[model samples]
Target chain A: MLWLTFILAGLATTLPRASFIVLGGRVRLPPTLQRALRYAPAAALAAIVVPDVLVVAGDFAPLNPNLAGVSAAVAAALLSRNPWLPFIAGMVALHALRWLPGG
Target chain B: MPSASFRAGAREGFLAFLPLSVGLVPWAMVTGMAMVGAGFTPVQAMGMNFIVFAGTAQLGTLPLIVAGVPLWLIVVTALALNLRFVIFSAAIAPGFRGAALPMRWFAGHLLTDGVFACCLEKMLAVDDSRWRLGYYLAPSIWSWALWQVFTLIGVFAAGVIPKHWSLEFMATIALLMLLVPLARQRPMLVAAAAAGATAVVLRGMPLRLGLIVAIAVGIGAGFAAEHWQDKEEAP
Candidate 1:
């Protein structure tokens, strides 16, 4: 089942990416459809990230260490486009929270 | 003789991709480690990496699969996350029109965000078709090679890295950073926030169905924002 899942997953993932190359010569996508596709990455990433970071063990805890850490990271990301800063700030905040007494 | 233009194309592709390749290293490692930590065997993780070759889709599906989500849901989510690649394909298709069928197939498989961006920038600049193969191949080959090597290191080294290192947190932040650049517009930001809020509220849903719901809502919100903006501009 695991291997089958991966195989099917590969097919699902590859077909769309490959579609335009294979079929694009004959068919053209409209411009508006293309523009709307831009929102996908942000939406998809948010869907993956929010649950893992904000909801710990199936409950919302806005004041938790991870959330606090992510707050610091999000601030860094907004300030500078450098990709590494967010992760660094997040790690530093997470560890700092851990070091706090009774945290 | 293989054309001098092809050689030049290849050289340009490699040079252009060098900086992006450096940026990909840490992202690759995080993906690799995340896969191992998610409970995939080294072999399985590498297999997924080889076949899927997409970090975002792979990472997005991991938690769901870990929770034993239905296979169809996982597949749908992966496809949704990868929908942008279809746009990339449309954008780059014209460059490969003259290539043979099998070569075009290979190029399609090799198309990645970084490689596609590099190749498209170069393709648009030069009108000649003779160099397209080399230009496309160079970055694709380099990205695949580097991604495989780094992911392998992460999978094998997973055990040695302590859990307390909090690598999951690192992965989340990395993903968020990736999200930052993409959310340039108000609609995109609204989409992200709506998705996050939806995911948080629906986190208890079985098989991570909440994620699917969130993605739908977010995309709808973005679409609606665009629609409203269009309406406002209509005179």
Candidate 2:
């Protein structure tokens, strides 16, 4: 059962993940579409990250991790267009907050 | 020449996993620790790493799996968490168009956050092939090795971090940081907001099925919004 599940899940995972690349340039998606595709990864990433940061202790704890993330992320987003800079800034703010009061 | 090229590519691929260690160190360790907390034997936990090959999803699903949530639910959730791989794969597809299938498979396995970003950065920045492979993947190789070792360490320290520190919260922050910069257009905005709302509404659903729903919703929303925006601008 485990093997079967793994195979099925792996196939499901690998196929969509591999679709664009496997189709290999035959899919002539517009440049605008590619630009749109760029947003999907980051957007999907946000969907997973927000709830956890915003909700603390299994309840809504807004001023805590979520604020730290959103604030620093907003800062990073605004200050630098570079990807790595904002990531580091946000991580530093979020994790370092561990030492704060009521944190 | 072919053997040399293949060998060279493999080496670069290995190097790509390296730079990712810093972030991966904590993330993977947390995952391994969670696996331990969930009752998987050490070997099984590590084995899961290779098979699933995603840090966030592993942590997300292990508890549900242990809780005896339906396998379908777990699979769906895992798939949702991993949906970014779709984006990652798509971004690099054009670059790898002329490469062989086996090469693409090998390179695709190296696709992750740090690898994707760093590789794309370096690949796009440089025009020369001489240092291209090394420059593209070395940092990521750093990340991959870091994650594996962190998983080993997290196995030990997993119990140390109290449950309430909300390390998961940090992941959320990391994600917001990752995405906010990319939300530049109407369709992207609609997709992001819709996906986020959907995820929250469906968070209570079985085995993270809400996430899958959210992903589909977000993608569809993005496509629809973009289509509408284009129509409005046209003629």
Q: Which stretches of candidate 2 lie over 4 Å from their true place?
A: A1-12, A26-30, A55-103, B1-21, B118-136, B180-198, B201-235
Which candidate has the highest TM-score of all?
1
Off by over 4 Å in 1: A1-5, A78-83, B1-23, B34-44, B56-100, B111-140, B201-213, B223-235
Quantify how close model 2 is to the true structure by its C-alpha RMSD in Å. Answer: 5.4
Tens digit of lDDT per residue, candidate 2, span A1-103? 5544445455555665666667767875667666556556645665676566556555655687557756886787678755456556665786678667877
TM-score of every model versus the real structure: 0.74, 0.70
- Per-candidate RMSD vs. true structure? 4.4, 5.4
DockQ of 1: 0.53
Give the alpha-carbon lDDT of every model: 0.77, 0.64
For candidate 1, write residues B1-235 as lDDT tens digits. Answer: 7699888888888987775465466667878988888899899999989988888788878888899989999998788667657767876777776777778778888877667644675664576676877888888899889989988988887888888978767767766665665577778888888888898888877656677678767877787787888899899
Candidate 2, residue A101: Cα displacement in angstroms equals 9.5
| Top model number, DockQ | 1
Q: After superposition, how far is residue B88 of candidate 1 from its true place, in Å?
A: 5.7
